[model samples]
Target: KREGDKWILNGQKKWIGNATFADILIIWARNEADNEVKGFIVKKDNPGFAVEKMKDKMALRIVQNGIITLTNCEVEEADRLQNANSFKDTAKVLQMTRAGVAWQAVGCARGAYENALDYTRTRKQFGKPIASFQLIQNHLVEMLSNLTAMQTLCFRLSQLQDQGLLKDEHASLAKVFCSLRTRDVVSKAREVMGGNGILLEYNVARFVADAEAIYSYEGTKEINTLIVGRAITGFSAFV
Candidate 1:
């Protein structure tokens, strides 16, 4: 709501990463008058902005996620994001972030693969290291294959983004594929770790849990799939 020279904002955003200590926050709200979503820059010192730190997340524990409440948050007209006039502008940011998430997934899977490989190489069984076993080698190869595929997809996605040809569907497809595949890669990493897989000392255990969080965030597998589906099929799967 607009009030003289300032806009009043009231709403809540939850599971927001970096909201707890962010110096500045970029918020998107629908202007009741125009019915178009607009962006606002809210400083952390604003009296109307309050945040509570979320606790005990299974993954992404390093990030401080918060729930933010804006109680009649007041913003100067000049604080509005000049380049972002509507929701479509907000979506452009998501497209880039989704691509970045795809790359993150690849990195996560690669770490799991490397850690699992090193563990197997020194983990002795039946008078030889487990890596000498045919089945263990097979698992290692499969993990590498999935990791390679994720890398290739994200590489092209980055190229498209650099070329300014990136589209929402392109980023969505990469996110959907890489996040889903990372889950598989991490699972295999744990599998090769034997009973030690679940142990925190092995490092693969964290990746296993982290994969679940990555699978859901930025967009879920089903939602990203629908984004690509709608683009190629010329229909809205969203109701």
Candidate 2:
């Protein structure tokens, strides 16, 4: 039921980052009249609003993700976003978030590559630094190549977005490619560290685990691939 100019919200949202600490929440609900999704800005400490912190994440433990529940949560009509009318409008928000995730993948990969390279330089084996060895050098070169390529791809992706020429497929392609490459770069980083790689204090292990999460978020590799596939083939392969 509506009260004056306010509407009621009742539902749950999962895997929301910072939900446990955010002062304001953007709640998406379907309008009963037209069945279109609408966005609402609900303030913290509102009646009937509750949030539970998500726990035991193997990766990205630093991020405070949570599950939010709203029970007859009151939100002013003025709090509703004026432009978001449906899920299609929601897509605009997701598109930007997806691009950010892609760039994050690049950053993660670059960090792993740099750390591993530095460790190999100082880490000695057989009385000499491992970075001097051919095998070790090869791994470093390959890691740099993939990291550089991902950086360039994300740079172009951002440029396209700035130019207003970016499309869903374009962002999807970068997300898919960069995320997969990040996984590879992290793996190489871990491999170069040998047994020390698995140790959390070494940092490579954290990157490895975090890369797994990055690989799956924004959109999984398979999902993003299909998005690009559908665009290129002119056929909707998504079932």
Compared with the true structure, all predictions reach lDDT values of: 0.93, 0.90
Which prediction has the highest lDDT against the true structure?
Answer: 1
Please give the RMSD to the true structure for each candidate, in Å: 1.0, 1.6
lDDT string for model 2 (113-164, tens) is 9899999999999999999999989999999999999989999999999999
The list of candidate 2 runs beyond 4 A from truth reads 1-4
TM-score, cand. 1: 0.97
Q: Where in model 1 is the C-alpha error above 4 Å?
A: none
Residue 116: error of model 2 in Å? Answer: 0.6
lDDT value, residue 157 of candidate 1: 94
Ten-residue stretch with the least lDDT total in model 1: 82-91
